[model samples]
Target: MGEHSKALEYYEKSIKIKEISLPLAHPDLATFCSCIGGVYSKMGEYSKALEYYEKSLKIREKSRPSTPPDLATLYNNVGQLYGKMEEYSKALPFLEEALGIFGKSLPSTHINIKIVMNAIDRVKEKL
Candidate 1:
């Protein structure tokens, strides 16, 4: 679990396999990219994390419906990554977008909506 490099290796291998078997725009490919982004984020490689996250976000944007929850999750991931990188100004808009989508799609009191709202508040405080 603490083996970040090992985790990354496996993630990359899985992505390669999925890429060969799945369509370019497949949601599974997006998810694979997002998983890699998360691993990079946990390793504190913020730039790499952002790159993979942007890849996932772009794929999801093209493949998923406009208001899919996965899109909100990717936005939240990018926002949190920016926040962790101390780029709060950049984080706020992404977090706010996640908050808006969660608000529209989830119950008012849903935990995800609450989490996104709290993240937005934290980013705003940093601004």
Candidate 2:
């Protein structure tokens, strides 16, 4: 519905404001990009979603999040989006990065570990 479009517009506005107010490399810009990406993903705009997600990743790489898992989560988001778009090959590395990070950062039995594992498995199945 229009609600999602409206939300996307609002997020875009917020991103513009943040860009003007914060440093060019600010992590909050990445957050806004991720939010917009998620909204685009939900709206089935895969290309636009990937665009914003990549922007977020670029910013995150520059900033280096407080936790490794934070970067992993972004990887996982991009990976999952690629998977959703049926680009299994593209999904593999990001999912692997996410898995590797989660493997190092969390306990073996952590749910995130399981989630990424399952996602990897699913992507592999598609491949």
Root-mean-square deviation per candidate: 1.2, 1.4
lDDT for predicted candidate 2 compared with the true structure: 0.92
Off by over 4 Å in 2: 65-67
Off by over 4 Å in 1: none
lDDT of 2 by residue, 1-127 (tens): 5988999989989999999999877889998999899999999999999999999999998887555887788899999999999999999999999999998999999998899999999999989
lDDT of 1 by residue, 1-127 (tens): 4798998899899999999998899999999899999999998889999999999998998897778788999999999999999999999989988988988888999998989888988888888
Clashes of each: 0, 0
Question: Relative to the true structure, how large is the alpha-carbon lDDT of every model?
Answer: 0.92, 0.92
Task: In angstroms, give how far residue 58 of model 2 lies from its true place.
Answer: 0.3
